[model samples]
Target: MEKSNANPSIECTVTECEYHCQDQQYCSLDSIRVGTHEQNPTQKSCTDCESFELKKSY
Candidate 1:
């Protein structure tokens, strides 16, 4: 899918995400859910984008 507007405030590089802007490093959604897998998150890697949805292949 082609996205017309990229949420400039949310910069994303995960192309596999359905909400990611195809042509730019940005997310199409205005807001995203953020979560952590570790009980005590200490770094950025511990956090995850809970809103990420894998793009469907046709």
Candidate 2:
């Protein structure tokens, strides 16, 4: 498997989106998956994320 950047800023969301924030900040977790909203129909909407105004987590 390809190694991902350990930097928290690189990941803007959580692995399971139930904890997603308005600013895009997420809690620390083992791993995360990314895809286009179209690909993952259940993906959280980050258009107006509050995390943008708050803080970012890895």
Candidate 3:
């Protein structure tokens, strides 16, 4: 998919994520990796965005 900031569908609150755009309100990546850390997830906290990359800037 073409990366565009015009799409105002996804709003990322995690500014520390590298996939997040410079604005810190949108995701640059076309898709995100979502998986659970445990064998069987029963809570929302158990899930993680595996595609999340730490941002070098603050």
Between candidates 2 and 3, the one scoring higher on lDDT is 3
Better of 1 and 3 by lDDT: 1
For each candidate, what is the lDDT?
A: 0.89, 0.40, 0.70
lDDT value, candidate 1, whole model: 0.89
Over 1-58, each residue of candidate 1 has an lDDT whose tens digit, in order, gives 4465799999999999888887999999978899999999999999999999898751
Candidate 1, residue 34: lDDT: 98
CA RMSD (A), model 1: 1.9
Across 1-58, the per-residue lDDT of candidate 3 in tens digits comes to 3334523555676778766665648877766778998998999899988878787665
- What are the runs in model 1 whose C-alpha is more than 4 Å off? none
lDDT of 2 by residue, 1-58 (tens): 1123243554555443333433545433344444443543653563333323222244
Q: Which candidate number has the best TM-score?
A: 1
Off-target runs (Cα >4 Å) in candidate 3 are 1-9, 22-24
Model 1 residue pairs with clashes:
none
The C-alpha local distance difference test score for the whole of candidate 2 amounts to 0.40
The 10-residue segment of model 1 with minimum total lDDT is 1-10
- Pairs that collide in candidate 3 are none
RMSD per candidate (Å) reads 1.9, 10.6, 3.2
User: lDDT: which candidate is best?
Assistant: 1
| Candidate number that wins on TM-score, 1 or 3 | 1
